[model samples]
Target: MSTATARSNLGNTIAAHAILITWTVIALFPVFVILINSLKTRKAIFREPLALPNAESFSLVGYQTVAKQGDFFLYFQNSMIVTVVSLTFILLFGAMAAFALSEYRFRGNSLMGLYLALGIMIPIRIGTVAILEMMVATGLVNTLTALILVYTAQGLPLAVFILSEFMRQVSEDLKNAGRIDGLSEYAIFFRLVLPLVRPAMATVAVFNMIPIWNDLWFPLILAPGEETKTLTLGSQVFIGQFVTDWNAVLSALSLAILPALVLYLIFSRQLIRGITSGAVK
Candidate 1:
Protein backbone atom coordinates (compact mmCIF):
# COMPACT_ATOMS: atom_id res chain seq x y z
CA MET A 1 0.00 0.00 0.00
CA SER A 2 1.12 3.61 -0.65
CA THR A 3 2.25 5.74 2.33
CA ALA A 4 -0.58 8.17 1.68
CA THR A 5 -3.16 5.37 1.80
CA ALA A 6 -1.60 3.96 5.01
CA ARG A 7 -1.60 7.42 6.63
CA SER A 8 -5.26 7.94 5.70
CA ASN A 9 -6.20 4.57 7.20
CA LEU A 10 -4.23 5.35 10.38
CA GLY A 11 -5.95 8.73 10.69
CA ASN A 12 -9.37 7.13 10.31
CA THR A 13 -8.55 4.51 12.95
CA ILE A 14 -7.37 7.20 15.37
CA ALA A 15 -10.52 9.26 14.81
CA ALA A 16 -12.72 6.21 15.30
CA HIS A 17 -10.97 5.29 18.54
CA ALA A 18 -11.21 8.87 19.83
CA ILE A 19 -14.95 8.96 19.20
CA LEU A 20 -15.46 5.61 20.89
CA ILE A 21 -13.42 6.68 23.91
CA THR A 22 -15.37 9.91 24.20
CA TRP A 23 -18.69 8.05 24.14
CA THR A 24 -17.46 5.50 26.64
CA VAL A 25 -16.44 8.24 29.07
CA ILE A 26 -19.82 9.93 28.69
CA ALA A 27 -21.55 6.65 29.48
CA LEU A 28 -19.41 5.77 32.49
CA PHE A 29 -18.91 9.23 34.00
CA PRO A 30 -22.14 9.16 36.03
CA VAL A 31 -21.36 5.78 37.55
CA PHE A 32 -17.81 6.91 38.25
CA VAL A 33 -19.06 10.00 40.06
CA ILE A 34 -21.53 8.04 42.15
CA LEU A 35 -18.95 5.41 43.14
CA ILE A 36 -16.32 7.95 44.06
CA ASN A 37 -18.71 10.17 45.98
CA SER A 38 -19.89 7.18 47.92
CA LEU A 39 -16.37 6.70 49.24
CA LYS A 40 -15.82 10.34 50.35
CA THR A 41 -16.96 12.22 53.40
CA ARG A 42 -19.93 14.56 53.02
CA LYS A 43 -17.80 17.69 53.11
CA ALA A 44 -15.38 16.35 50.56
CA ILE A 45 -18.23 15.16 48.33
CA PHE A 46 -19.75 18.63 48.30
CA ARG A 47 -16.43 20.47 48.01
CA GLU A 48 -14.66 18.34 45.44
CA PRO A 49 -17.35 16.30 43.74
CA LEU A 50 -15.09 15.13 40.92
CA ALA A 51 -12.04 14.36 43.00
CA LEU A 52 -11.13 10.79 43.88
CA PRO A 53 -11.03 9.58 47.48
CA ASN A 54 -7.74 10.54 49.11
CA ALA A 55 -6.29 9.66 52.50
CA GLU A 56 -7.85 12.68 54.18
CA SER A 57 -11.26 12.50 52.49
CA PHE A 58 -11.80 8.75 52.29
CA SER A 59 -14.63 7.40 54.43
CA LEU A 60 -16.83 4.35 54.72
CA VAL A 61 -19.52 6.14 56.71
CA GLY A 62 -22.06 5.94 53.91
CA TYR A 63 -21.73 2.21 53.48
CA GLN A 64 -21.75 1.85 57.25
CA THR A 65 -24.98 3.82 57.47
CA VAL A 66 -26.55 1.80 54.70
CA ALA A 67 -25.54 -1.49 56.26
CA LYS A 68 -26.80 -0.44 59.68
CA GLN A 69 -30.16 0.86 58.45
CA GLY A 70 -31.22 -1.76 55.91
CA ASP A 71 -31.50 -5.49 55.46
CA PHE A 72 -29.15 -5.41 52.47
CA PHE A 73 -28.73 -9.16 52.32
CA LEU A 74 -32.48 -9.84 52.46
CA TYR A 75 -33.15 -7.26 49.77
CA PHE A 76 -30.45 -8.79 47.61
CA GLN A 77 -31.95 -12.22 48.12
CA ASN A 78 -35.41 -11.04 47.10
CA SER A 79 -34.04 -9.45 43.92
CA MET A 80 -32.12 -12.60 43.05
CA ILE A 81 -35.10 -14.89 43.74
CA VAL A 82 -37.50 -12.86 41.63
CA THR A 83 -35.05 -12.48 38.73
CA VAL A 84 -33.97 -16.14 38.66
CA VAL A 85 -37.42 -17.70 39.00
CA SER A 86 -38.91 -15.35 36.44
CA LEU A 87 -36.09 -16.00 33.94
CA THR A 88 -36.46 -19.75 34.39
CA PHE A 89 -40.20 -19.72 33.74
CA ILE A 90 -39.82 -17.34 30.82
CA LEU A 91 -37.20 -19.54 29.13
CA LEU A 92 -38.94 -22.87 29.69
CA PHE A 93 -42.47 -21.81 28.72
CA GLY A 94 -41.34 -19.40 26.02
CA ALA A 95 -39.14 -22.03 24.36
CA MET A 96 -41.89 -24.64 24.48
CA ALA A 97 -44.45 -22.24 23.05
CA ALA A 98 -42.05 -21.05 20.34
CA PHE A 99 -41.11 -24.59 19.40
CA ALA A 100 -44.76 -25.58 19.07
CA LEU A 101 -45.58 -22.60 16.91
CA SER A 102 -42.56 -23.00 14.66
CA GLU A 103 -42.24 -26.78 14.28
CA TYR A 104 -45.84 -27.93 14.06
CA ARG A 105 -48.79 -26.94 11.91
CA PHE A 106 -51.86 -26.83 14.05
CA ARG A 107 -55.14 -24.96 13.91
CA GLY A 108 -54.87 -21.40 15.23
CA ASN A 109 -51.07 -21.56 15.21
CA SER A 110 -50.84 -18.23 13.44
CA LEU A 111 -53.42 -16.74 15.74
CA MET A 112 -51.56 -17.96 18.80
CA GLY A 113 -48.30 -16.56 17.49
CA LEU A 114 -49.96 -13.22 16.80
CA TYR A 115 -51.49 -13.12 20.25
CA LEU A 116 -48.16 -13.78 21.93
CA ALA A 117 -46.38 -11.31 19.67
CA LEU A 118 -48.83 -8.59 20.71
CA GLY A 119 -47.33 -8.52 24.16
CA ILE A 120 -44.00 -7.41 22.66
CA MET A 121 -45.55 -4.23 21.30
CA ILE A 122 -47.68 -3.54 24.37
CA PRO A 123 -46.02 -2.31 27.52
CA ILE A 124 -46.89 -4.39 30.58
CA ARG A 125 -47.16 -1.23 32.70
CA ILE A 126 -50.51 -0.60 31.00
CA GLY A 127 -51.93 -3.62 32.86
CA THR A 128 -50.53 -2.69 36.26
CA VAL A 129 -53.91 -2.02 37.80
CA ALA A 130 -55.29 -5.34 36.62
CA ILE A 131 -52.16 -7.21 37.63
CA LEU A 132 -52.24 -5.70 41.11
CA GLU A 133 -55.93 -6.46 41.48
CA MET A 134 -55.45 -10.07 40.42
CA MET A 135 -52.49 -10.44 42.72
CA VAL A 136 -54.55 -9.07 45.60
CA ALA A 137 -57.40 -11.45 44.87
CA THR A 138 -55.04 -14.41 44.59
CA GLY A 139 -53.31 -13.53 47.88
CA LEU A 140 -49.99 -13.23 46.03
CA VAL A 141 -49.44 -9.56 46.83
CA ASN A 142 -46.25 -8.77 48.74
CA THR A 143 -44.83 -12.17 47.85
CA LEU A 144 -41.79 -12.99 45.72
CA THR A 145 -44.07 -15.35 43.85
CA ALA A 146 -46.14 -12.38 42.74
CA LEU A 147 -43.08 -10.61 41.35
CA ILE A 148 -41.95 -13.80 39.62
CA LEU A 149 -45.35 -14.31 38.02
CA VAL A 150 -45.54 -10.71 36.86
CA TYR A 151 -42.03 -10.69 35.43
CA THR A 152 -42.50 -14.05 33.77
CA ALA A 153 -45.67 -12.80 32.11
CA GLN A 154 -44.00 -9.54 31.07
CA GLY A 155 -40.91 -11.29 29.61
CA LEU A 156 -42.64 -14.17 27.83
CA PRO A 157 -43.77 -12.47 24.61
CA LEU A 158 -40.35 -11.23 23.49
CA ALA A 159 -38.77 -14.49 24.56
CA VAL A 160 -41.27 -16.46 22.52
CA PHE A 161 -40.87 -14.18 19.53
CA ILE A 162 -37.09 -14.43 19.48
CA LEU A 163 -36.94 -18.13 20.25
CA SER A 164 -39.57 -18.98 17.64
CA GLU A 165 -37.53 -17.39 14.85
CA PHE A 166 -34.50 -19.36 15.96
CA MET A 167 -36.56 -22.52 16.30
CA ARG A 168 -37.80 -22.11 12.72
CA GLN A 169 -34.22 -22.16 11.52
CA VAL A 170 -33.55 -25.53 13.16
CA SER A 171 -32.99 -28.11 10.40
CA GLU A 172 -36.15 -30.08 9.61
CA ASP A 173 -33.98 -33.06 8.79
CA LEU A 174 -32.58 -33.16 12.30
CA LYS A 175 -36.07 -33.16 13.82
CA ASN A 176 -37.24 -35.85 11.37
CA ALA A 177 -34.18 -37.95 12.20
CA GLY A 178 -35.11 -37.74 15.86
CA ARG A 179 -38.57 -39.01 14.97
CA ILE A 180 -37.09 -41.79 12.86
CA ASP A 181 -34.97 -42.84 15.85
CA GLY A 182 -38.19 -43.40 17.84
CA LEU A 183 -37.78 -40.25 19.93
CA SER A 184 -40.96 -38.65 21.16
CA GLU A 185 -41.74 -35.07 20.17
CA TYR A 186 -41.10 -33.92 23.71
CA ALA A 187 -37.80 -35.77 23.69
CA ILE A 188 -36.80 -34.12 20.46
CA PHE A 189 -37.49 -30.67 21.89
CA PHE A 190 -35.88 -31.29 25.25
CA ARG A 191 -32.82 -33.12 23.89
CA LEU A 192 -32.14 -31.68 20.46
CA VAL A 193 -34.11 -28.48 20.04
CA LEU A 194 -33.25 -27.00 23.41
CA PRO A 195 -29.53 -27.39 22.88
CA LEU A 196 -29.76 -25.92 19.41
CA VAL A 197 -31.54 -22.81 20.61
CA ARG A 198 -29.41 -22.25 23.72
CA PRO A 199 -27.72 -19.21 22.21
CA ALA A 200 -31.04 -17.45 21.55
CA MET A 201 -32.19 -18.32 25.05
CA ALA A 202 -29.02 -16.83 26.48
CA THR A 203 -29.57 -13.64 24.52
CA VAL A 204 -33.16 -13.41 25.69
CA ALA A 205 -32.23 -14.15 29.29
CA VAL A 206 -29.55 -11.47 29.36
CA PHE A 207 -31.86 -8.93 27.80
CA ASN A 208 -34.82 -9.68 30.08
CA MET A 209 -32.98 -10.35 33.31
CA ILE A 210 -31.59 -6.79 33.57
CA PRO A 211 -35.04 -5.21 33.63
CA ILE A 212 -36.31 -7.75 36.12
CA TRP A 213 -33.37 -7.22 38.45
CA ASN A 214 -33.62 -3.44 38.32
CA ASP A 215 -37.41 -3.14 38.50
CA LEU A 216 -38.89 -0.96 41.22
CA TRP A 217 -42.54 -0.39 40.40
CA PHE A 218 -44.03 -3.85 40.94
CA PRO A 219 -41.92 -4.42 44.01
CA LEU A 220 -42.85 -1.04 45.49
CA ILE A 221 -46.55 -1.40 44.70
CA LEU A 222 -47.13 -5.06 45.42
CA ALA A 223 -44.39 -6.03 47.82
CA PRO A 224 -43.11 -3.04 49.81
CA GLY A 225 -42.75 -4.97 53.04
CA GLU A 226 -39.32 -5.18 54.63
CA GLU A 227 -38.89 -8.83 53.76
CA THR A 228 -40.04 -8.46 50.17
CA LYS A 229 -38.14 -5.33 49.16
CA THR A 230 -35.79 -5.74 46.22
CA LEU A 231 -32.45 -3.98 46.17
CA THR A 232 -33.76 -1.35 43.77
CA LEU A 233 -36.82 -0.49 45.86
CA GLY A 234 -34.92 -0.78 49.08
CA SER A 235 -32.21 1.55 47.84
CA GLN A 236 -34.78 4.03 46.61
CA VAL A 237 -36.57 4.07 49.92
CA PHE A 238 -33.33 4.32 51.82
CA ILE A 239 -32.05 7.15 49.67
CA GLY A 240 -35.31 9.02 50.00
CA GLN A 241 -35.17 8.84 53.77
CA PHE A 242 -31.56 10.03 53.79
CA VAL A 243 -31.57 12.39 50.84
CA THR A 244 -29.98 15.11 52.93
CA ASP A 245 -27.07 12.80 53.57
CA TRP A 246 -25.25 12.89 50.25
CA ASN A 247 -22.78 10.22 51.24
CA ALA A 248 -25.46 7.74 52.24
CA VAL A 249 -27.49 8.50 49.15
CA LEU A 250 -24.52 8.01 46.87
CA SER A 251 -23.58 4.80 48.67
CA ALA A 252 -27.06 3.42 48.27
CA LEU A 253 -27.02 4.26 44.57
CA SER A 254 -23.62 2.63 44.19
CA LEU A 255 -24.81 -0.49 45.99
CA ALA A 256 -27.80 -0.81 43.66
CA ILE A 257 -25.63 -0.22 40.58
CA LEU A 258 -22.63 -2.45 41.26
CA PRO A 259 -24.49 -5.77 41.22
CA ALA A 260 -26.13 -5.04 37.90
CA LEU A 261 -22.83 -3.79 36.51
CA VAL A 262 -21.01 -6.91 37.65
CA LEU A 263 -23.73 -9.15 36.24
CA TYR A 264 -23.64 -7.41 32.87
CA LEU A 265 -19.88 -7.68 32.70
CA ILE A 266 -20.13 -11.40 33.47
CA PHE A 267 -22.86 -12.27 30.94
CA SER A 268 -21.89 -9.70 28.28
CA ARG A 269 -19.59 -12.22 26.63
CA GLN A 270 -22.42 -14.76 26.38
CA LEU A 271 -24.73 -12.09 25.00
CA ILE A 272 -22.21 -11.16 22.30
CA ARG A 273 -21.48 -14.80 21.55
CA GLY A 274 -25.16 -15.60 21.18
CA ILE A 275 -25.70 -12.73 18.77
CA THR A 276 -22.63 -13.54 16.68
CA SER A 277 -23.29 -17.32 16.61
CA GLY A 278 -26.92 -16.78 15.60
CA ALA A 279 -25.80 -14.38 12.87
CA VAL A 280 -23.22 -16.84 11.52
CA LYS A 281 -25.71 -19.70 11.43
Candidate 2:
Protein backbone atom coordinates (compact mmCIF):
# COMPACT_ATOMS: atom_id res chain seq x y z
CA MET A 1 0.00 0.00 0.00
CA SER A 2 1.06 3.57 -0.64
CA THR A 3 2.09 5.75 2.32
CA ALA A 4 -0.90 8.07 1.79
CA THR A 5 -3.33 5.14 1.63
CA ALA A 6 -1.88 3.66 4.84
CA ARG A 7 -2.15 7.03 6.52
CA SER A 8 -5.79 7.34 5.43
CA ASN A 9 -6.64 3.93 6.88
CA LEU A 10 -4.90 4.79 10.13
CA GLY A 11 -6.82 8.07 10.30
CA ASN A 12 -10.13 6.28 9.85
CA THR A 13 -9.27 3.75 12.57
CA ILE A 14 -8.28 6.50 14.93
CA ALA A 15 -11.50 8.40 14.27
CA ALA A 16 -13.59 5.31 14.94
CA HIS A 17 -11.82 4.62 18.20
CA ALA A 18 -12.20 8.22 19.28
CA ILE A 19 -15.94 8.18 18.59
CA LEU A 20 -16.40 4.92 20.51
CA ILE A 21 -14.46 6.23 23.48
CA THR A 22 -16.51 9.41 23.51
CA TRP A 23 -19.76 7.51 23.46
CA THR A 24 -18.59 5.23 26.24
CA VAL A 25 -17.77 8.16 28.45
CA ILE A 26 -21.11 9.80 27.68
CA ALA A 27 -22.98 6.63 28.57
CA LEU A 28 -21.08 5.94 31.78
CA PHE A 29 -20.98 9.49 33.10
CA PRO A 30 -24.42 9.29 34.68
CA VAL A 31 -23.67 6.01 36.38
CA PHE A 32 -20.36 7.38 37.65
CA VAL A 33 -22.03 10.51 38.97
CA ILE A 34 -24.75 8.54 40.73
CA LEU A 35 -22.34 6.10 42.33
CA ILE A 36 -19.99 8.78 43.59
CA ASN A 37 -22.85 10.85 44.95
CA SER A 38 -24.23 7.84 46.73
CA LEU A 39 -20.98 7.56 48.68
CA LYS A 40 -20.81 11.24 49.62
CA THR A 41 -22.59 13.13 52.37
CA ARG A 42 -25.70 15.03 51.35
CA LYS A 43 -23.88 18.38 51.85
CA ALA A 44 -20.94 17.27 49.74
CA ILE A 45 -23.29 15.76 47.19
CA PHE A 46 -25.12 19.04 46.75
CA ARG A 47 -22.05 21.23 47.09
CA GLU A 48 -19.62 19.34 44.86
CA PRO A 49 -21.96 17.15 42.91
CA LEU A 50 -19.34 15.90 40.48
CA ALA A 51 -16.58 15.29 43.04
CA LEU A 52 -15.67 11.79 44.13
CA PRO A 53 -16.28 10.92 47.77
CA ASN A 54 -13.11 11.61 49.78
CA ALA A 55 -12.67 10.54 53.36
CA GLU A 56 -13.97 13.81 54.76
CA SER A 57 -17.06 13.84 52.52
CA PHE A 58 -17.90 10.12 52.64
CA SER A 59 -20.79 8.69 54.61
CA LEU A 60 -22.70 5.39 54.87
CA VAL A 61 -25.85 6.99 56.25
CA GLY A 62 -27.72 6.39 52.99
CA TYR A 63 -26.92 2.71 53.01
CA GLN A 64 -27.81 2.54 56.69
CA THR A 65 -31.16 4.18 56.03
CA VAL A 66 -31.89 1.81 53.19
CA ALA A 67 -30.93 -1.21 55.32
CA LYS A 68 -33.09 0.00 58.15
CA GLN A 69 -36.18 0.85 56.11
CA GLY A 70 -36.16 -1.58 53.18
CA ASP A 71 -36.16 -5.34 53.26
CA PHE A 72 -33.60 -5.52 50.44
CA PHE A 73 -32.85 -9.21 50.93
CA LEU A 74 -36.50 -10.11 50.56
CA TYR A 75 -36.83 -7.91 47.51
CA PHE A 76 -33.71 -9.47 46.02
CA GLN A 77 -35.07 -12.95 46.73
CA ASN A 78 -38.37 -12.13 45.05
CA SER A 79 -36.57 -10.81 41.98
CA MET A 80 -34.38 -13.89 41.78
CA ILE A 81 -37.33 -16.27 42.05
CA VAL A 82 -39.42 -14.40 39.51
CA THR A 83 -36.56 -14.00 37.05
CA VAL A 84 -35.36 -17.60 37.30
CA VAL A 85 -38.79 -19.24 37.17
CA SER A 86 -40.08 -17.03 34.40
CA LEU A 87 -36.90 -17.56 32.35
CA THR A 88 -37.19 -21.35 32.78
CA PHE A 89 -40.76 -21.41 31.51
CA ILE A 90 -40.01 -18.99 28.68
CA LEU A 91 -37.04 -21.02 27.46
CA LEU A 92 -38.79 -24.39 27.75
CA PHE A 93 -42.02 -23.34 26.05
CA GLY A 94 -40.27 -21.15 23.51
CA ALA A 95 -37.82 -23.86 22.57
CA MET A 96 -40.62 -26.42 22.19
CA ALA A 97 -42.66 -24.05 20.06
CA ALA A 98 -39.66 -23.07 18.03
CA PHE A 99 -38.64 -26.67 17.51
CA ALA A 100 -42.11 -27.66 16.39
CA LEU A 101 -42.38 -24.77 14.02
CA SER A 102 -38.94 -25.22 12.53
CA GLU A 103 -38.65 -29.04 12.32
CA TYR A 104 -42.15 -30.24 11.53
CA ARG A 105 -44.42 -29.98 8.50
CA PHE A 106 -47.78 -29.27 10.02
CA ARG A 107 -50.98 -27.56 8.97
CA GLY A 108 -51.26 -23.84 9.74
CA ASN A 109 -47.62 -23.87 10.78
CA SER A 110 -46.96 -20.58 9.02
CA LEU A 111 -50.11 -19.09 10.52
CA MET A 112 -49.19 -20.26 14.00
CA GLY A 113 -45.68 -18.86 13.62
CA LEU A 114 -47.13 -15.56 12.54
CA TYR A 115 -49.56 -15.62 15.43
CA LEU A 116 -46.76 -16.08 17.89
CA ALA A 117 -44.69 -13.41 16.20
CA LEU A 118 -47.48 -10.90 16.63
CA GLY A 119 -46.70 -10.65 20.33
CA ILE A 120 -43.31 -9.22 19.43
CA MET A 121 -44.88 -6.03 18.13
CA ILE A 122 -47.82 -5.81 20.45
CA PRO A 123 -47.08 -4.53 23.93
CA ILE A 124 -48.47 -6.60 26.80
CA ARG A 125 -49.50 -3.52 28.73
CA ILE A 126 -52.70 -3.33 26.67
CA GLY A 127 -54.09 -6.39 28.44
CA THR A 128 -53.26 -5.21 31.95
CA VAL A 129 -56.90 -5.01 33.02
CA ALA A 130 -57.70 -8.49 31.77
CA ILE A 131 -54.49 -9.88 33.30
CA LEU A 132 -55.33 -8.29 36.61
CA GLU A 133 -58.86 -9.69 36.52
CA MET A 134 -57.60 -13.18 35.77
CA MET A 135 -55.01 -12.97 38.52
CA VAL A 136 -57.67 -11.87 40.98
CA ALA A 137 -60.00 -14.69 39.96
CA THR A 138 -57.23 -17.24 40.34
CA GLY A 139 -56.29 -15.86 43.77
CA LEU A 140 -52.82 -15.07 42.50
CA VAL A 141 -52.91 -11.33 43.10
CA ASN A 142 -50.09 -9.89 45.21
CA THR A 143 -48.07 -13.07 44.71
CA LEU A 144 -44.77 -13.94 43.04
CA THR A 145 -46.60 -16.55 40.95
CA ALA A 146 -48.57 -13.78 39.27
CA LEU A 147 -45.38 -11.95 38.32
CA ILE A 148 -43.78 -15.16 37.01
CA LEU A 149 -46.74 -16.03 34.81
CA VAL A 150 -46.96 -12.53 33.36
CA TYR A 151 -43.23 -12.28 32.66
CA THR A 152 -43.17 -15.72 31.03
CA ALA A 153 -46.00 -14.69 28.76
CA GLN A 154 -44.24 -11.43 27.97
CA GLY A 155 -40.91 -13.07 27.18
CA LEU A 156 -42.06 -16.18 25.29
CA PRO A 157 -42.82 -14.55 21.96
CA LEU A 158 -39.43 -12.92 21.44
CA ALA A 159 -37.67 -16.01 22.76
CA VAL A 160 -39.51 -18.25 20.32
CA PHE A 161 -38.87 -15.90 17.45
CA ILE A 162 -35.11 -15.78 18.04
CA LEU A 163 -34.80 -19.50 18.86
CA SER A 164 -36.85 -20.60 15.84
CA GLU A 165 -34.48 -18.84 13.44
CA PHE A 166 -31.52 -20.63 15.02
CA MET A 167 -33.34 -23.96 15.25
CA ARG A 168 -34.03 -23.87 11.53
CA GLN A 169 -30.30 -23.82 10.90
CA VAL A 170 -29.78 -27.18 12.67
CA SER A 171 -28.53 -29.91 10.31
CA GLU A 172 -31.19 -32.12 8.72
CA ASP A 173 -28.68 -34.99 8.54
CA LEU A 174 -27.99 -34.72 12.26
CA LYS A 175 -31.67 -34.94 13.10
CA ASN A 176 -32.18 -37.92 10.78
CA ALA A 177 -29.19 -39.70 12.28
CA GLY A 178 -30.71 -39.22 15.73
CA ARG A 179 -33.97 -40.75 14.51
CA ILE A 180 -32.18 -43.71 12.91
CA ASP A 181 -30.43 -44.35 16.22
CA GLY A 182 -33.85 -44.85 17.84
CA LEU A 183 -33.91 -41.48 19.45
CA SER A 184 -37.43 -40.20 19.96
CA GLU A 185 -38.26 -36.65 18.84
CA TYR A 186 -38.08 -35.49 22.46
CA ALA A 187 -34.71 -37.12 22.89
CA ILE A 188 -33.43 -35.55 19.68
CA PHE A 189 -34.55 -32.15 20.85
CA PHE A 190 -33.21 -32.32 24.38
CA ARG A 191 -29.95 -34.06 23.49
CA LEU A 192 -29.05 -33.09 19.94
CA VAL A 193 -30.86 -29.95 18.85
CA LEU A 194 -31.09 -28.20 22.19
CA PRO A 195 -27.39 -28.45 22.89
CA LEU A 196 -26.56 -27.05 19.46
CA VAL A 197 -28.76 -24.01 19.92
CA ARG A 198 -27.61 -23.31 23.47
CA PRO A 199 -25.86 -20.14 22.43
CA ALA A 200 -29.11 -18.78 21.06
CA MET A 201 -30.88 -19.91 24.22
CA ALA A 202 -28.33 -18.09 26.35
CA THR A 203 -28.85 -15.01 24.23
CA VAL A 204 -32.60 -15.30 24.68
CA ALA A 205 -32.28 -15.83 28.43
CA VAL A 206 -30.06 -12.78 28.83
CA PHE A 207 -32.35 -10.65 26.70
CA ASN A 208 -35.46 -11.72 28.58
CA MET A 209 -33.81 -11.43 31.98
CA ILE A 210 -33.28 -7.68 31.71
CA PRO A 211 -36.95 -6.89 31.20
CA ILE A 212 -38.10 -9.37 33.82
CA TRP A 213 -35.65 -8.13 36.43
CA ASN A 214 -36.32 -4.45 35.71
CA ASP A 215 -40.09 -4.54 35.12
CA LEU A 216 -42.26 -2.53 37.45
CA TRP A 217 -45.64 -2.62 35.78
CA PHE A 218 -46.60 -6.26 36.26
CA PRO A 219 -45.22 -6.35 39.77
CA LEU A 220 -47.10 -3.21 40.67
CA ILE A 221 -50.39 -4.45 39.28
CA LEU A 222 -50.30 -8.12 40.24
CA ALA A 223 -47.89 -8.37 43.16
CA PRO A 224 -47.53 -5.05 44.93
CA GLY A 225 -47.30 -6.49 48.44
CA GLU A 226 -44.09 -6.03 50.41
CA GLU A 227 -43.30 -9.74 50.55
CA THR A 228 -43.70 -10.07 46.80
CA LYS A 229 -41.91 -6.89 45.72
CA THR A 230 -39.08 -7.29 43.24
CA LEU A 231 -35.98 -5.15 43.57
CA THR A 232 -37.16 -2.73 40.93
CA LEU A 233 -40.47 -2.12 42.64
CA GLY A 234 -38.89 -1.99 46.06
CA SER A 235 -36.31 0.53 44.87
CA GLN A 236 -39.03 2.74 43.45
CA VAL A 237 -41.05 2.57 46.65
CA PHE A 238 -37.97 3.28 48.74
CA ILE A 239 -36.99 6.25 46.62
CA GLY A 240 -40.49 7.68 46.64
CA GLN A 241 -40.80 7.48 50.41
CA PHE A 242 -37.36 8.93 50.87
CA VAL A 243 -37.50 11.44 48.06
CA THR A 244 -36.41 14.25 50.33
CA ASP A 245 -33.46 12.20 51.55
CA TRP A 246 -31.06 12.40 48.64
CA ASN A 247 -28.58 10.07 50.28
CA ALA A 248 -31.06 7.23 50.67
CA VAL A 249 -32.46 7.74 47.19
CA LEU A 250 -29.01 7.60 45.66
CA SER A 251 -28.08 4.57 47.71
CA ALA A 252 -31.27 2.77 46.74
CA LEU A 253 -30.63 3.52 43.07
CA SER A 254 -27.01 2.35 43.35
CA LEU A 255 -28.17 -0.86 45.00
CA ALA A 256 -30.68 -1.37 42.22
CA ILE A 257 -28.14 -0.70 39.46
CA LEU A 258 -25.30 -2.78 40.93
CA PRO A 259 -26.89 -6.24 40.66
CA ALA A 260 -28.12 -5.75 37.10
CA LEU A 261 -24.76 -4.35 36.05
CA VAL A 262 -22.92 -7.32 37.55
CA LEU A 263 -25.23 -9.79 35.85
CA TYR A 264 -24.79 -8.13 32.46
CA LEU A 265 -21.03 -8.05 32.85
CA ILE A 266 -21.05 -11.80 33.49
CA PHE A 267 -23.38 -12.68 30.59
CA SER A 268 -22.23 -10.10 28.05
CA ARG A 269 -19.57 -12.44 26.68
CA GLN A 270 -22.13 -15.14 25.89
CA LEU A 271 -24.47 -12.60 24.36
CA ILE A 272 -21.79 -11.35 22.00
CA ARG A 273 -20.79 -14.91 21.16
CA GLY A 274 -24.37 -15.88 20.35
CA ILE A 275 -24.84 -12.97 17.97
CA THR A 276 -21.50 -13.47 16.27
CA SER A 277 -21.94 -17.23 15.91
CA GLY A 278 -25.28 -16.78 14.21
CA ALA A 279 -23.79 -14.20 11.88
CA VAL A 280 -20.89 -16.49 10.93
CA LYS A 281 -23.32 -19.31 10.09
Best by lDDT: 2
lDDT of each: 0.92, 0.93
lDDT of 2 by residue, 125-176 (tens): 9999999999999999999999988889998888889999999999999999
Overlapping backbone residue pairs in candidate 1 total 0
- Candidate 1 at 231: error in angstroms? 0.9
Candidate 1 wrong stretches, greater than 4 Å: 1-7, 273-281
Query: Per-residue lDDT tens digits of candidate 1, residues 154-242?
Result: 99999998999999999999999999999999999999999999888889998898899989889999999888999999998998899
* Number of backbone collisions per candidate: 0, 0
Model 2 earns a TM-score of 0.92
- Pairs that collide in candidate 2 are none
Top candidate on TM-score is 1
